[model samples]
Target: MTPSHPPISGASSRRLGFLLAAGAAVLFSAKAILAKFQFRYGLDALDVMALRMGLALPLFALLAVRESRRAAAPLQARDRALILVLGVLGYYLSSLLDFWGLQYVPVSLERLILFLNPTFVLLLGVVLFKRRVARREWVALAVSYAGVALVFVESLRLEGDHLALGGALVLGAALAYALYLALSGELIHRVGPLRLVAYAMLVSTAVTAIHYVIARDPAGLLRLSAPVYGLALVNAVLCTFAPVTMTMAAVARIGSGAAAQLSALGPVSLLFLRGWLLGESVSALQVLGTAVVLCGVLLLARPAANSVPLDPIDDPLPGQAGNPPGR
Candidate 1:
């Protein structure tokens, strides 16, 4: 049921954005699982990113080539410069940092730290747009933040130095990711989601490849035959392509800050999915933690900024961002 809160200036748009963001989270959750699969098969973290991006590059390019036709004029010099920076920061550099940090930190703690992205996004909105969050949004934010803190404290208590480092790296990932969404939100208005993601992924993949060319061992990449390749493909398709596309689409609908708030679901989904897939038993605390985070999602979904005047549900336009791509 829709909450009592009055919707924002654009209720329908915000609702549209929220669903797409959650859809993105479902796909984005696979990142950890696929990375774990690669590690299990003996591929180093860098090698895994390298192989995954190598495959991802062409697919991104194919879309980009098609989307570029939408532009009325050649990309301005400033946009090209921004694209370069965004490509390096959003995907290659930040992702590599996450990989390195994961080596040092505990898994759950890293997720908790990464959850700070919403906070970052909020802070950026305040600073950049003078956008003030409403009371309900604040409450939802608190619940989400509190949930993350509890999980992190519990996770760290059971950890090592590597896990600790992972926590720091994940924090950086959150910051970079926040920057990506905030900036990309503005840029999407200019470039459109499809072209932006396509170009960004293509450039980011090329940038990642340069690192692999310098130090990667070809034998290491080839060691794991079919399973590893399949996992890498899964990582690229689900983790990178699918979610990022939704995120961009969400940005197009609602502002990126709202979308970022919903992004708190990623780690929560990861915990459950990881536990279920690996057959790892979840303790009471973890389940409680997941519930706490979910409460935050339901609260945020209450339609704080926009007013929903329609029926129980609003039918979205075709090719909507939240649905599976091309649906």
Candidate 2:
């Protein structure tokens, strides 16, 4: 029998890609942690979400229009309708929920919830599409979630009920986003990713605007201070636009599921960033838990026989901070 040889270079490339994805995590992890800074400035959550999305829209639109002119993919009316539904659910609604939830949750805790994309994707794929999850993949999913538990414990200590509730909202958002990942590839093939993001943002803006009208959010929009404005800039450009675009690029390279799976490590990374940035001084027990959780994430990344093609539609990252529509 011949001994199997490993693809050393391929492994190296995947590591590089994972590191890039981790870079995405670092940028994304910063959003909510910084948003916590807004309390000093008295910024409302809705107003922040609105501003964040508003700033990002123009930039995304410019690229989307150029892409439309270059490699446009046409879809039938039904397809258009489904895509719209997806955009509203995945990008618009999810963003609203996350920003609102952020007020009640620590950034670290919310990251754990948001990173549940892999679990949501796996369960959704298995139950809805009858897809098979590799045994090792299952272990990875469990480990990724263990990381969530670690973060949640610390988050709970930091923010109490607010953190738990915020984590729950982000979990719901992650589930919706997971569904978006599962189906977005087929949709992207019908329409390019740029256009998909543009349309999704537009649709999300419309939806969020209506919700604001109904709920009467953005009461504090005009009173935003300098620090608040700065956070809004980070939310819109750095967290919303930059990482979203880069993650979409990653989706184009790897598949959305794999990308999302790797993203499960985001909360752990955020834990350290927040600790370093905010002097969070996480407990020794939490550090141990974080390590254990990370080990689970590595298990998920272990080689599988087949890797799925990616079509990740990262409309609204399940992150913290955004300005309400028209805020």
The candidate that achieves the highest lDDT relative to the unseen native structure: 1
RMSD of each: 7.2, 6.5
Alpha-carbon runs more than 4 Å astray in model 1? 1-23, 104-112, 127-141, 244-265, 296-327
- Candidate 2 on 75-97: residue-level lDDT in tens? 68977797788777777767667
Candidate 1 local accuracy as lDDT? 0.63
Please provide TM-scores, in order, for all candidate models, with all chains considered together: 0.75, 0.78
Error of 2 at 274 (Å): 1.5
Task: Give the Cα RMSD of candidate 1.
Answer: 7.2
- Give Cα-based local distance difference scores for all models: 0.63, 0.62
**lDDT, candidate 1, 69-171, per-residue tens:** 8776678888888888878877887777776666655444455555545456555665775665666667767887787667666666655345556766777
lDDT of 2 at 104: 81
Query: RMSD of candidate 2 to the true fold?
Result: 6.5
Name model 2 segments beyond 4 Å from true. Answer: 1-22, 217-220, 248-265, 301-327
